[model samples]
Target: MPSIMIADRDPNERTGIGWLVSSCAIPYEKVLSAGTMAEVFQLMESQTPDVICLELDMVGKGQWDRLKLLVDQYRPTVLVTTAEATFERAMQGIELNARDLWVKPQTPEYIRRVLTRCCQDQSYRMQMSQETTGVTGRAGEVSYLDLFFPRPLHGRTYPIMLAQLEDPKHHPELLRFFEDYPFRDKPVLLPLGDVIVGVFPDDTHEPQTLFHQTGKRLLMDWEAMSDAPLFLVMYDSKEREQSLNEKYLDAIQALHIRFFKGYRQLTIVERQVNWTMIDPFLTPSEQRLWVDMLHGGDPEVLKQWMYRHFSYKEEPYPEPGLLRIRLTSILAQVRRYMKSHGLDNGDLEQEYHRVFETILYSPILYRIVAEMLLFIQRLMDLVQNQREEVRVDVIEQAIRYMERRFTDSGLRLEDVARHVDRSPAYFSTLLTQKQGTSFRQLLTSLRVKEAQRLLLETSLSVGEIAERSGFVNANYFSKIFKEKTGTTPRLLRNQKKR
Candidate 1:
């Protein structure tokens, strides 16, 4: 049985959810409801439900900060429900780590399915916790073990490395031997027998002793101490499936190692090998990819693998260019995926293009990564650094230029593009690529924003604001303004006055 909490402002909506849960016979021990953000947090503290279904629109302005705090503290699987499901709204939900999003007019069956999935997910997490002994322990105490499948051990057909350090024959004698050894607690140890393992002990105990003796032997054999290390790389979507399906896994497995699959991600285990011995298996392009993946941890063997693999290739230019091309293609694919899934606004496409351009032209791979990170950081720093460099600078400029000239009545995008020193077609493509919105939409938004500012910040009447903002007719402006803002300009002005 799962406990569920519903956070919706409408009384009818709360009642509707209550009835749905009851009809499903979900074995819900408690069904708590709240109509405001404050109530939601209060109820959350008191009830501590297994799941939280939040109404996206009902949340008041600036409530996301408090919502995120509650989410972090409780760690409940959140399901966001909203009447208006836009890419911006969906992205907000994703940022908050909401597990799923449901729109209004949802069928009872759909609601039941979502709740069931949430329950199943919770059960799976609990089961994994029991199996892995709660992965949230101190890093030192957490034993880092690597399962390596060097040359397909024992003719096992499955592509997995199952190495356990608990084997008695190899580890027991070593543990006993280390009982009186010095340097027991100063340094970490890498143990090797049939498998490789890195042990960091929590206490001055036998496990530490075993690690010292066994780690030395393993290092002597492989000439290195760390166990398998995994790296996660996020690339563009189209090439992602192909990259994952193609060289990404094969390259890591070429070292005869184990890896785990994740959504558009891979975790690779660290391998210990002589630099001179394994330098024959990587191309320059492959080397860059490996380095990119190794950013999370120091998998130096991967660098050695790259060096060895590319030793025979005399040409250096093609490899880096190829790597950049592959990365750019991946980024483009990711943008397409985001658009198709309605996960982001169209602006991502333009941002992706800019990132791709910057990365491709950069002299070094590390520099490219640094610049990309800085761009993302700038975009995220919207509250401060009011005019900071962002991935969307080009689009922002276009929007500003349009807003300044929109009152001209006969203002055209071509004229705007000329002012920006770009061709009309190129500017159009850029706008569409970055804004995800068409030229008409940009123009309309500029007018709407201006209308809103005038209504809220000035004493101008609605009709006057509409005319000054470039609408041919005041009535049409009022209609479009209401459509965009969900409030008539006159009403908005009245509210501002009060």
Candidate 2:
């Protein structure tokens, strides 16, 4: 006969949560609903519930302290809901000892699972407390959780497993997995900041192959629960001069090998980690080779080069930090290619920045390589498309060059002709023949159009706008502007204001 309370600002959300809770198999004697903080407090004061579901957004700043006090006093299993899935909200849940924090609009199945898990946890804790009332702990008796610090080893050795997430910042989230692990005799689960160390009992005598199989099973189970990659390093401690703490450190060092081996697979470390020496920076010759390949624009050749250098794995692997540095060297050449092709701005620039960050922070080499290959394919496609478009019309190419440099006050017919690989005289004659306008006339029209746009949109003075629009002489610019638009720059701006 457990009682539960559901609190939210919206009536629909409150009813939805109540329905989901009722649909769960756990039988509840009372299902209370509250739409305000005052109502929630009234319900809690009147009837002590076994569980509480609260929306954090509706809780005002003044109510936080009182709510936290009530929660600590009643000690109900609390599940908080939030509109924003941010770290601050999560920290608030941790402060109230909430079992879970659900973002708004969660699926019914997920909500049910969370509620069931919280209820189960509450029941288990109550049962354990009752069973250990008189036989809790004698003086000087050490608990298994104390194994994290320096302790007496007595020259004993035990099999240990170091479980770590690909990104160690998520170590707190990993604790839930060990809470309901299926092990018959649960091992001592120790959290050492970035990694979780499980120290098995001394009676364990599993073979190396069996230990590896168990590690794989645990990894598969974790993958089923979370998408983040987990690295589980197993080591059977042979009676050596090292303490349990030292063995744990050795396993942590072994995790670096995943930089080469990739993640989502169990690793069995038999000995110390060994890293070979390597020059992380590219040599002058390699830089030249990268430039040549980029210029060649052959995807097959670039693919072969990537596979040959990065995909081939050998013993005594290079240090991961150094390999990351070398990857940046390759990116340097790619950046130059992008700049040469005018791909250094807008979406292409953002894509390049993403690849740069992935190279620096991605946990596995295979993922970095995969992202780089995809970016390279996009770059090659864009380059080929630009080449085909330019080949279709030389006059279009000349016009594009002029459009890009029209803001430069010193730009002339020779510059556009050189960009399209034609002499000044030939280019001028071709321009008039195609567009029925002289080069100077076309350039002036482009500049005047830009000046008119600036007049309408910006607050700049007439002289400043004229200079920005590639007009050196203010008087000439004013005459041309009037001729083109039939109004002065100041008059146009004043008319728009009216």
Candidate 3:
């Protein structure tokens, strides 16, 4: 029987996650929850759990150091639960032996799938550890001597199947599964650490069922267990060529094909000569849909919109060169959108090559698409610099409009905004930010300045000054002028004579 432990600082998360994991009924001997590192240590001393659902946020203090110590000491299958999970964090969580990391807001179903995989892995490792001594492979290579019996003395050309690992971490489980594969009686699978190879001369006595046996056996029940796709290249020695070495060469060519075209169904090197590339797929109908979004100037929303276009249904399987070309076509849409915002296409080819090269370097199809989408996002983010230039011009125009019309007593904020071709609310905010005051306050200050100038520089009476300065009446002018300069308008004119 296996055991499970849940460790987290948050009580709600500890209990909630524990309850959900237990609901899966993963055949555990014990299920314990820990709120602190002290409790985690205590439970670990009593019985080191077979599986640990660890919350990285609860690790606290030393963070990665503490987590490393726990992982090294216990050697438990650790499933990390983090509030924030990025690609880098997930990469850090991948240990050579046992660790699965997931982010929060995950459904019970996803948790169950990960937990099931962990338990199955842990159980397989424990069983294999005792049964096979030299079978534990090194990181880089595998020893063929410890793996299989010395090559059959009746050396004849045998069929070979080659598959590149989706994740090299799954090598041990895959190798172990191949050891007792219920498919063929005499087939021997050689685990090369990074690659899995199968030799079939076992059923050659049945000659007709020779090549079809391995492919047909794998198609049943294997796909459901491993959602991760592998680059599978299977070759037939009896059907195609006379030499086993030639068939092995064909397997190698097929693997290289996967590196370029991206992984899909069984690839036959013998059958796939003269395969044509996909036609240029620049769908003009969908051009406006993506262009308007880039001009709208939110890279994050544009990225999400791009993500919706991705699906596994890439029919008439595309070549690596064709896929790269498709990526460039999508990027050209962004460039077209940028041109409207004053981006020059002068060094566009150099810029396009840099991003296109980066997209091609992605190992998987979805990853290639994701990298291109992120590039488009960064491209759209550059539009903010242009937007900044436009904003300054609009604010300057609004300020000048206010200065020329301040003496008009019936001046309204709406009319000023309309003069500058902006909404009243937007113009008001820009004016307040730029001039440091509201429309009404600036208008009053301008009128008072004119009243003060007439008192000092002209022989104008208080009532006459008020009429010319855009005040409603002489009494209102006196009240406002006295409030502004702390003296009546008539008194200021008399004082100036002294």
Which candidate should be chosen as best, given lDDT against the real structure? 2
Task: Give the Å error, residue 221, model 2.
Answer: 4.3
RMSD of 1: 30.4
- Put down candidate 2 lDDT per residue, 416-450, tens digits, no spaces: 98988889998888888788999999999999989
Over 4 Å off, model 1:
134-498
TM-score of 3: 0.44
Worst 10 residues of 3 by lDDT: 133-142
For candidate 1, which ten residues in a row score worst on lDDT?
256-265
Model 2, residue pairs in steric clash: none
Candidate ordering by lDDT (highest first): 2, 3, 1
RMSD of each: 30.4, 20.6, 19.4
The lowest-lDDT stretch of 10 consecutive residues in candidate 2 is 133-142
- Tens digit of per-residue lDDT, candidate 1, span 1-498: 557898888899899988888888776678999888888977775566779989999777788776775565456889998888799789879977898888887888888888888877776765654454311224332233322322211211111112223232545444332322232122233344543222222221123223333333332322232232222221111221222123223432322211112111222322221122222234567556643543323334433543443233221123444555654543443344345434354565567667878766643454455455444343334323332343267667778888679876678888887877778887788789777988888888888988888888889877789889999888999889888989988888888778
Candidate 2 CA-lDDT value: 0.80
Clashing pairs in 3: none
What is the C-alpha local distance difference test score of candidate 3?
0.65
In terms of lDDT, model 1 sits at 0.56
